[model samples]
Target: MDLPEIQSIDDLALLVEKLKLGLVSAATSDEYEFSDEEYKRIRKILLSNPMFTELIPSYLKLCRNLSGVWQYIKHEFSTYAERRGFHY
Candidate 1:
């Protein structure tokens, strides 16, 4: 499938939702884990994307909030089939 063009934070969030879903599915089906390289790639995608760049500050803040609990955050993303709420 063709990837959607990201041109706004909403678009980025939507893309992230898809990615999170994929990660969850992969974790179950293929035991996927984020490698350092893969993590770098994700960060690169977000920072390089024009739309995501516009919301970098908010993104950074979110990251800061989750810094100590990154493993928990990853586990949540990797297993949850649906996003339950907007606590993030």
Candidate 2:
């Protein structure tokens, strides 16, 4: 399948939704994790598309942005499972 273009913050929001993100609490005795293989597969698919590969840096800054720019991405990530979905 073709990967969706995440060229902007809006696009990233949509991508987060499509991926069905959610959060989990680490305080509990039980913990969930996503395997390296699964992670690699998603990255592979994303990088498979030139658009996603080229825009990766911009996408990353959404988190690295210390000026509270990460809030947007953080909100999107709130819907993802703790340690389950994409990190950035």
**Which portions of model 1 miss their true places by more than 4 Å?**
1-18, 21-30, 55-88
**lDDT (0 to 1) per candidate:** 0.46, 0.41
Q: What digit string (tens of lDDT, one per residue) describes model 1 on residues 1-88? A: 2333566878767656654544343334435444434434455566666755776545332442223224444555643433222123
Candidate 1 overall Cα lDDT vs. reference? 0.46
The weakest ten consecutive residues by lDDT in model 2 span 21-30
Candidate 1 worst ten-residue window by lDDT: 79-88
Q: 31, model 2: CA deviation in Å?
A: 2.6
Per-residue lDDT tens digits for candidate 2, residues 1-88, read 3555557777656544432221122111124453334334445555566666665545433323222323544555554343344442
TM-score of 2: 0.33
